[model samples]
Target: MSLSYAYLLTQMVIFIPAIESWLRADPHEVLIVTTIEWYERIKASLETVDDPRVIVHAIEVKSKRPGLIAGIQRTTTDHVVLLDDDSIWSLATLQGLLCGLSAGPRVAGVSNIKVNIRMTLPALAPDAPSMFEAMGAGRHDRRAATNTAMAYFCDSQITCYTSETTAYRTEALQRPGFVEHVVEDYWKGKCKLSSGDDGAITRLYQNGRKTGIVVHDECAIEPKSKENTDYLKQILQWSRSEVRQLVRDPYLLLPSHRRH
Candidate 1:
């Protein structure tokens, strides 16, 4: 259908401003996918333009992966960009990410933050080095080399950034395996979901799949606030459950990866 392009947004109250940034920044034909509750609260904040380019979907599903992947699948777009509740981007950053995806087939992902090209570390631990650092656990301003495995590995680690604004190509990202990482359930009074999309993508790339990054300094991020304390507790509980299950059967989520 005209080689459509779209943007996916997970919402809460704070992200309304960021959504405005997205609506203005992404190319025409970009769709915004958000929870029904969130859409009800935030949709009105966006000014109505007669432009048929923006479409909104009311998401009933609570899990991040299913809902987001479903949104991507529903889109007629050839390219899809993903954003979280806390990320705000400049027009330049948005264009750069899209252009990076348009670069070539070998590039499966595009990162919006600064990236450190020369470092390696394990996947999934707080101690893991910042995927954007110049070196593992060290910061430097050096530019990264082009198309190296280590360069791709750095891209993989960045796949773990749950709250940061990022975008993806739909054809490459909609695989069933990638959607399996979303975990969701009611923790307290409110329905909640934990994001594991990036982590799963990181695992795929680390397993030798190809991906890429678009480093831009102007892209800024706002921290996500856990407004629902009970939801936070539930997330903690779910994480513990996942760890225990993984320990009992290493293949449950992470395989050949040590608990420590």
Candidate 2:
């Protein structure tokens, strides 16, 4: 049961913590993909680890999808786990995801549950809990409810699986259709997408040819928004991706295609 972990990097501070967690998980190999400019910096930062299993690949392309495709091409393991730099997982979580992939041959991928974390200003109000603390509490409750619905009412209806922390069988990803589904450009190549990788992959598995499962492990991810403008930009990008995907493949929005 060999596993390969692949992720793109932008900032050292965020990537270092994520790398630390991945090292603790002890995968067969770790694949880091980033721009050529940051390659040396990232390599230098990770040099103290002294682990031969870690491999870094620098690409000239600025898009995230191409880096991910390169990493997938380089993976030689039985399973590949695609992750985001902002997400962290436990060793047990990694084990659970691998176990899920072993359940069946048709299982294309397994996605773990995610909890959102946001930074808050606690210094402004010392007497009350920080916004981060309050939001964390609410997020957990919402996560519980979402998990319950997924387990009982919507297990077969789940169509979208997050790429932040997903494990896929190498064979499934090697399928010609799946590869094209992931790396294809939309809107006449005007948009080099940074988002919607998750949605695209989800559509492939939900197309009745394969299966995508949601595991019960906890995978924590930080919010993408640092300020109002950042949040708005993220929303706009996501909306554009969603619209483009719909135009490219309307079957994903159909009732039968989403019936698990």
Cα lDDT of all candidates, in order?
Answer: 0.48, 0.63
As for candidate 2, its clashing pairs are: 156-260
Cα displacement (Å) at residue 184, model 2: 2.1
How many steric clashes between backbone atoms does each model show? Answer: 0, 1
Q: Candidate 2: global Cα-lDDT?
A: 0.63
lDDT (Cα, tens digit) per residue for candidate 2, span 55-160: 8888887777777787888888888888777566665767777776777777778766654332243445655444434544354445445444543444433445
Look at candidate 1 and give me any clashing residue pairs. none
Top-scoring candidate (lDDT): 2
lDDT of 1 by residue, 63-181 (tens): 56655665666766566666555455566766777676677665666655533323343555555544323122131222123223234544332323232455566766666655544
Q: At residue 61, give the lDDT of candidate 2.
A: 76
